[model samples]
Target: MIEYCLTVLGFVLAIVGRMDNLRGFVVLPKRWIVERFFAHLMRSRRLVRDFERSTTSAEAMIYWSMTMLMTRRLARQPPRRG
Candidate 1:
């Protein structure tokens, strides 16, 4: 029983070591990403604001647009198999 426990603990530690490497590899550049995102937003700021205010309709259009955008994005992504 003691040897079985030791082997299982070592196996868990090995898997955890690889997880640490993956964590480092997955971290992205925060500053550059924020700057690029803001630049893109600024480019379309006027157009988006104008469209948002042009109609006196309810906010459903905005919500619908966001839902469709997210749905399309999710649909385009590949499925993850367990």
Candidate 2:
């Protein structure tokens, strides 16, 4: 059931092409998204500084930061209606 819903959504998004600009070229939504995510991550003082020496730890901090940010957003927003 979820697969069917996801397949349908893929078709719908393909038609919409939200990633495209007026010239039919792919816009840099990913770059914008990454930049925005980092902006939020920087709100954490630990992330703002290069305190983590290990790459694994840095990546973990990023994941932890994103989790906190998402949970906070989810808490603020009402649940979706079907």
Candidate 3:
């Protein structure tokens, strides 16, 4: 009887632990999404042409340039040694 109860409790604990992992992995789009959107924008001709002819082009260029710089900086930073 004691062995059966311990087995049931272990099963319940396993189910709860898996549920926590599922919740932790689910995330909303944010920084990674914005960067990816611009990375795609760089490949697209529509925005490139529009930027070439419009006043907003400078702003778009600056924003994308800064974002790219930041991405590079983040990538090269050494991980904490501690």
lDDT value for model 2: 0.78
Residue 32, candidate 3: how far off, in angstroms? 31
Residue 40, candidate 3: Cα error in Å is 21
TM-score of every prediction relative to native:
0.28, 0.54, 0.32
Q: What digit string (tens of lDDT, one per residue) describes model 2 on residues 1-82?
A: 5566578765332222363435665547666776787799999889999999899999999899989998998889687899
Q: lDDT scores for all predictions?
A: 0.52, 0.78, 0.60
Report the lDDT tens digits of candidate 3 across residue range 1-82: 5566578765332111233545445534454576786766665444555546566876777577667667877889698897
For candidate 2, the C-alpha RMSD (Å) to the true structure equals 10.2
Clashing pairs in 2: none
The better-scoring model by TM-score among 1 and 3 is 3
Model 2 regions more than 4 Å off: 1-30, 77-82
Q: Residue 28 of candidate 1: its Cα lDDT? A: 47
Q: 14, model 3: CA deviation in Å?
A: 65
For residues 1-82, what per-residue lDDT tens digits would candidate 1 score against the true structure? 5566578765322121233545344524555576665454444434346456445442555555556656777889697899
Lowest summed lDDT across 10 adjacent residues in model 3 is found at 10-19
